[model samples]
Target: MSRRRQRVGALAAGSVVVCALGAPVAFAAPATTSEITGNGAWVAQAYENTATGIYLTPQQSDVEGPARAPFGSGSHRMVIGESTVQTELYRTPKYDGTPLADITRLEYSTFARRTNGAGALRQPTFLRLNVDKDGDGDQDEQLFFFPANNTDQQAVANGVWQHWVVTGSGLLNVGGDAGAGSATTLAAYKTANPAAELINNDDPADGTATTADGGSIALITGGGNGGGTDSQANGEYFVDRVVVGLDGVDTLFDLGPAAAVQTVATSGATVTPSNLQGWYHEAYDAVDYLDSNQAFVDGPGATPAGGGALRFALSTTTNPDRVELFRTTQFDGTLVRDLRTLKFSTFQRATGANTTPQQPVYLRLSVDTNGDGGMDDTLFYAPANNGTVAQSTWQSWDAASGVWGVNGDQGNGSVTLAEYVVAHPDAVIVKNAYQDRPGGGVAFLVGASGASQMNGEYFLDDVTIGSVDAATGRTSSAKRFDLDSVAPAVSVGDARVLEGNSGTVLNFPVALSRAVPRAVAVDFATVAGTATAGQDFTAASGILTIPAGANSGSITVKVASDKVREPHEALSVKLTARDYGTLGKAVGAGSILNDDTKVALELGKAAKHRVEASVKTKAPVAKATVKLFRVVKGKNVRVLKDELSKKGRLSTVLDEQFEKGTKVKLFAKVRTPHGVYVSETVRHTVR
Candidate 1:
């Protein structure tokens, strides 16, 4: 079928939802904007088929699922039906106007079911390329690849995902007036059609576009409307991770819902939750997995609302260890009776040794009910005891409504937060530390006992806590902590200074990606380069401590300078911090620019025909070769050249006879490992 003939207007307003490959057909609530679009570079335009809505959907298989989840937490689902030519075309102008000769690879992944049905033999979609042959303003050719027609494509079934290559041999076939036959390869197509250029309908109103406001490469599915096998196909297909290769660079489009699309955080970045925002991590006697754990990850059901979730690990195998994330001063003295919302999201994986899956961390609140200066009441909400826990997916719990266990109120029937608050109306969060116990605060605790939980990893995110006014039933404020795995990365900035005659300090600024609760110490030392330490610069090595809650520090090194005309020199400063933070760009470069500029060549009176030549600069010349040359036949011919005079001065006597007014040039050259340093040509007369 000719896809170009079916081009139409905007997509119809509606929504379509589908389950993953093997899952049963279930209707989901309409997708929000966040779940349908991610990158603004792409747009969906429908033709022939009646699409409720053409956008990205979060309903996708996990990373370990049948489909290769590439960019985000979802994929681009195209709803096809009995329509003769149903097409939900996704386009991007990013590669528009690119010549076919520069394209090296074109690939995409699609999910399809392998069952005996009307669309069993039909491929996912046709990879179409709108071409402007002969460089005209109008699109004249449509080159496309039908995976069903290409024998090189994978023939596996069983309801899984597969990849299709559209640039290699036996892939692309020309359509329309270009004739109908396999183009074999992109290179061959470009050779035969030398004027082939990718033309996209990226902007219809622009009047200059050969296509529309869409894009170049169109992901088309559902061709020809009919109940038969060749035309209409009754199936839903998912397209994701479209890779477009142009001029040796590949750009991937991670198709997913819009609101849920977020910038995935760096895995092990140690981020200190902000205190001003009512969240912070307190330093406890636990091993901080700054480099060993992930702070952000993506998968189906990995994160609750977005493409990223927090992954952290705690251990009870050794000493008591748990992450002590706390809210600063906002909840210090708040009465537990006013607490309204308390909930968090977690992802628990299946356990091999036990039938029941591992439990998530606990939500604890240190309360003082007896009016004592210390916190005597500890209330905990355990996931294993309160809610229905599951494995290998994300789930949330309303800790406030669930059962809560107090220090002395732990029986078979643990009371809820509402019941405990009603009994102890005076119970308030303690704000002072007492007897090694952190006073009156909320925290997530795990791993103090039990082998079943020992050495197990856990993921936590979207922690929310709020208070309500009982009289008005109004929520005063809700605080949510976005727990992430990113740790602070330490790096040093480059420094430059003039090589002074004396000690000159070169300050190199050290920075961290984020501040931490504990002081960070980084060891640094100057390494020798073109400039030697203790000679050109002072050798320094020591620990630089970045105080807690600070993100920057500096290191100073004294550089020595001799006032002699020489080329600029450089040295390296290396940093190492194994216990504090991860090293980003560990080494900083130092440049010592030459500042001395004075250079002179003096001619003195001599009794013999010999003429004296000496070179001098701001400082005493040392081991410099002096050369004397006189113009001969328009070219300066070398007459005398040697190191220094016997008296240890940059002086040489020219014995060659010359006219009194003859103009000769004196040159001085100094050789070093870096490069040769030569003075400006000093013209002197041989009087």
Candidate 2:
């Protein structure tokens, strides 16, 4: 029969409790939204079957007996007539079992009874399996069948119920019979008939027997009279010791209502927990773990509520020597909503250990706000380990004083205003820190509220929370890198000056302690000197090099323009250093422009000169060679050697060289490669 067609009924004292009779059964309570966020724990009720055992009274249709022990119910009893019974099963949150996969084996023990002088009553039984395979809250597969034992049996006597039962297990065949004797092993049964049907039994004789296997079978009942009398009720069957085998096991982390748990494994690597809310770091020291346990409560009711202790086991080979804890919490105590806590416990171990120590591990606790997976608030406690006792009470932040402080009181501490503002400028104050110390135990309390409390990012690293030195008594803050130690220095050498000239070199000196990726620019400006339109003085090279770790270097400056006449002009040479670091910041000097002196000159009158002339010829003289000569102080002097022409003419300036009233004689000579030619003497007088 189909799963929807199966029905289950409970035979109570003079009453029948019908559970799933072609209807949906609700075994678990509906989950609420608040419970889903806070507690994350829920479970379904247990399912009971009452119609599969012996009857207490012959006249009564229902069976009742001694109370059951395991689940705190009554004795094993069932109705004695032909009827249909159904029971509803539910899913539980904390059961240590696996999800039902393929069916492995189904075995149950039952006792049959034939009564009322009947010619061996015949009864056929059916079983149904239900599952929400599609996640649609409905049963998917149904497995139903009749037993193979529906045959004739000899009754012990008439008008009395005789017991004839099958207590051993066996596989159900397609025809609903004990498939080739009784089933002794699950693997053998599964291998025999891969598509076996449900087991059912029908006996024609009035027989009664007790069955020990009661927990395996889901539902069992009897119907269909044997003698074809349409009596509708005759024989009865009792079931017990029902055992079903299935696949994997379930973990406790899957207890929440719609909660999902993911497992990850790594070797020789640091583990960082991510995508968490309302908590700080997932690792902590031992002392901090104890402190947080005292300060915070699990859920609203606080009794058998949601939160509980979290445990972690290290590998056998890990022998940790030291450990630390980290957490994330809101800096400001305001914005209490969306608050979460993450606890981390770490241990340091030896290099070549095969087994770890049994005791002495560190623990810590942290709180996260804004949901950024980082802890904004953290608490630390150092527990007694290896016979060492802890002396400090508790460590927390002081927002008012803007520092971390210690509190000795056991009650919850107050909010720290100043420190909170520095860490979270936009946060609002909600709750403060509180601690409890009794019986040599320490606890720290933290509370707060603000807008979007469940939003933001937070993180934690390995460090102390609020410990201060006894001598100094100063709190510590986070560390960060000085940009003010970089400057530039420059120097200019002596300027070379040339009279009435330009284009001179001016040298410069630069010093640096290290090599830098930077560009140096040098510019020359006229300070006081003026240059003529035609004269040009310019900077020859604008870039300079400072070798790596070099103390000093020289740069040449060119003067392309001339200085003016008035006051001596000066040229300003500016050197700019770009991209300087700490060493460069030490020097603050720039380009220096200075002046050099220059002088002017004047022109004088013209002087007189003398001239004589001569000429030589290679071929016959086709033309005459005239010689031009000058005389000084009545002495003859030659200026021009000769003048070659068809006819020669000569003139000389003798008066300019001689005094007034002086007479002079001028002569000339001409020669060729073949011979020589001489001209007659000429006389000139100066007056």
Top model number, lDDT: 1
- Local lDDT at 13 for model 2: 15
* Regions of candidate 2 where Cα sits further than 4 Å from its true position: 1-503, 513-536, 539-545, 561-567, 581-687
Question: Once superposed on the true structure, which residue ranges of model 1 sit more than 4 Å away at CA?
Answer: 1-358, 364-380, 385-600, 608-610, 616-625, 631-634, 645-650, 661-665, 669-674, 683-687
Tens-place lDDT digits, model 2, residues 449-511: 011111111111122222211122122222100011122343444444442333455554555
Clashes of each: 27, 128
Ten contiguous residues minimizing lDDT sum, candidate 2: 13-22
lDDT of each: 0.59, 0.28
lDDT of 2: 0.28
Model 1 C-alpha lDDT per residue in residues 1-687, reported as the tens digit of each score? 111222111111111100010112222111111111244677666654333322333222213223434334456766565634555676677778888888875877777542335444555666788888889766787787776666556663425657677776645777721323444567788888887888874434324444464777787765465465643266656776676656644555656554232222222222233312444444233223212233354333425432345555555444334333343455777777567678888775533444434667566777777667456566667776665667666788898788765652243445666455433445787654423333336765544424434455566767777764333222355666655434468899999998766667789999988776456678999988899887888999999888766899999999887857678889988999855456888999999998764556677655454577776544444555555555566686777666744333675667877777767665555433323445666666666
